[model samples]
Target: MAKEKIVLAYSGGLDTSVILKWLKETYDAEIIAFTADIGQKDELDGLEAKALSTGASKVYIDDLREEFARDFIYPMFQSGALYEGQYLLGTSIARPLIAKRMVEIARAEGATAIAHGATGKGNDQVRFELTAAALAPELGVIAPWRMDEFREQFPGRAEMIAYAEKHNIPVQASAAKPYSTDRNLLHISFESGMLEDPWFDPSATSNEEMYVLSVSPEEAPDQAEYVELEFEQGNCVGVNGEAMIPLEIMEKLNELGGKHGVGRVDMVENRFVGMKSRGVYETPGGTILFAAHRKMESLTMDREVMNLRDSLNARYSSLVYNGFWFAPERLALQALVTESQKNVSGTVRVKLYKGNVIGAGVKSHVSLYNPDIATMEADPTKAYNQNDATGFIRLNALRLKVASGVEQNAKK
Candidate 1:
């Protein structure tokens, strides 16, 4: 009889390394480790070798930076998807893509099961499983953190660390670093440990130690810097007069935004699992892009159309935040957002100063703003007729006058 094969979404981190070994032993299965590269930087170093030596039949490291930025980040940004009106959906948006690729690998490798290191309490377990259920319902999901047996064997980080040492599993996690971090092209998010306290002040040290994408606002340069962003159909195409692809654009913006201390958000958000979780995110490029995109849309979008899109923004944001990236409603909302962005093409200039993204100017050849009609000094174009106000106001006030008459009659 052949050994059962299981595909593991491996990060080459402490938790995953232990899970890789544990899964293999528990199920008596051949473990195939898969790591998705979405701008995790040095985290991918020696991952294949580590997985192989740590006891894995096969190791697959995929570079999905282009697909991630272009497919996932751009569409979410186009929808103005922001969780709880604050979080940029950094970690939330990355889950579906990871799960999608995991499913693809599972099918290609002829694996019977897929496993992840996401905990039982967090949103990622839902994101991963929901995606798997939607895409590959036949594949079994083995979540060790959710299993009581696994939890009993390894209840805390110290137990996992000891087990790793005893089993000769090399891991990056340690007791010294209290919090855990998740990183991708869009942003780096930190949670757990001291960050769990809502009232905890990361500003004490400006959180320079934990933050990877940007410097602290206090540590930013004294002088403000101006940046110009070019957009086409609501997608940022270039920065500072240079044309670049999505991946390149994100890299450059990360550099620029990080230098200026532009994007750092710390908030206590309501999780889909009905618990409040505190998160600190560093999203330099995304912050700059969102501000520039809003400015571009303001110049080119119709008022009513923009209002409708604005109303859908929260709903669209919730869909993504709740791991509904593959849901039908999210697709419908995406279609509407894409339609709304057709004319949102322009250049927006912004000044970045000590965490502030202040808009300087915006322009588009297809802009709906009419200087002549809106000028307060005088309408030399004769576009405005002062006589028009009389009938317009009286007609608008007719209902108000009728309501007043009724109230007066009742009072009498």
Candidate 2:
């Protein structure tokens, strides 16, 4: 009988690399290693060779940068979803996309199971498994970190390192840095290690080694910089009047935002598995986009509609954070979010200075801002009638007056 085929979500990192070898030895399965390239910069360098050398039967690396920004990031941004009112949902958002692609690969390769390196204690395991279950219910999901056999054999990173050494596997991990990191186009996140302490400040070092996408606010240039963003139906399409593709737009914004030290967040966030984790994130471009997008919406969106969407922002963000990206509820909410963006086309000017993304100006052709009626200066031919306010105030105040009278009667 042929050995079972397993598709592994390989990141070329120490954990996933060790998992790849362990899976082969324990399951006696053929491992097809998969890596999703979502703008991790130099992290993808030599990944293919490394996977192939580490007992992978085949190595697949796909560049999903454009799809990631256009499909996942933009729709989530449209909802203005922020996990726990702070995190950009960078790591949370990427999991679904990775899982979706892994499922497709599994089906194509006739694989029976998909494996991930997410630890049992962390949220990524839930994210990866939920997505796989939603997309491919028949496929078996394997989590090495959750397996007792795997844990007993390799209790910690030290044992894993020793195993790698014994098996002659090449790994870049070292005891010097005990933290884990996840990176993509939107942001780079650091957790564990010294960052595990909520009060620990990574910026104490002059190098600011923890940050990959932006500089420290104190180290940023003294002068502020301005940039213009153009949006069409709530999607950022151009930067500084230059029309660019989704990937190019992110690249440019990341550069500009990073130079000005924009988009750095540190917080202890609630994980879906009921634990608090301290994370430091650098989301330079995403910060600019979020600020500029909201500014543009202020001019173009209807008041009531904006309020309704804002009310659901927390629910929408929780759905994303909890690995429900492919859930029907999330899709339904996304549809409403998309519908709300139909009129959200405009330009927003932003000032970037010392980790701040400040909106300078916003304009839209379909703007509801009627300056003629709203002007403070008296206009003889203003559209708004001054006499209209008397009746409006009287009618609105009647309910309050009646309630007061009822209260006085009860007291008597």
TM agreement with the true structure for every prediction: 0.96, 0.97
Residue range 1-412, candidate 2, lDDT tens digits: 9889999999988889999998998899999999999999899999899988899999999999999999999999999998888999999999999999999999999999999999988889999999999999999999988889989998988898898899888888886677888999999999988788787878786437767888888889999999999999999999999999888999999999999899998899998899988998899999999999999899999999999999999999999999999999999999999999999998999999999999899999989887777888886557888899999999999999999999999999
lDDT of each: 0.92, 0.92
Residue-level lDDT of model 1, residues 1-412, one tens digit each, is 8899999999988889999999999999999999999999999999999999888999999999999999999999988777888999999999999999999999998999999999999999999998999899999999999999999999998899999999888887766678999999999999999888888887678456777888889999999999999999988999999999999999998998999898999999999999998998999999999988988988899999989989988898888888989988888999999999999998999999999899999999899999998998799889889899999999999999999999999999
Query: What is the Cα-based TM-score of model 2?
Result: 0.97
Clashing pairs in 1: none
Worst 10 residues of 1 by lDDT: 202-211
The whole-model C-alpha lDDT of candidate 2 against the native structure comes to 0.92
Q: RMSD (Cα, Å) of candidate 1?
A: 1.6
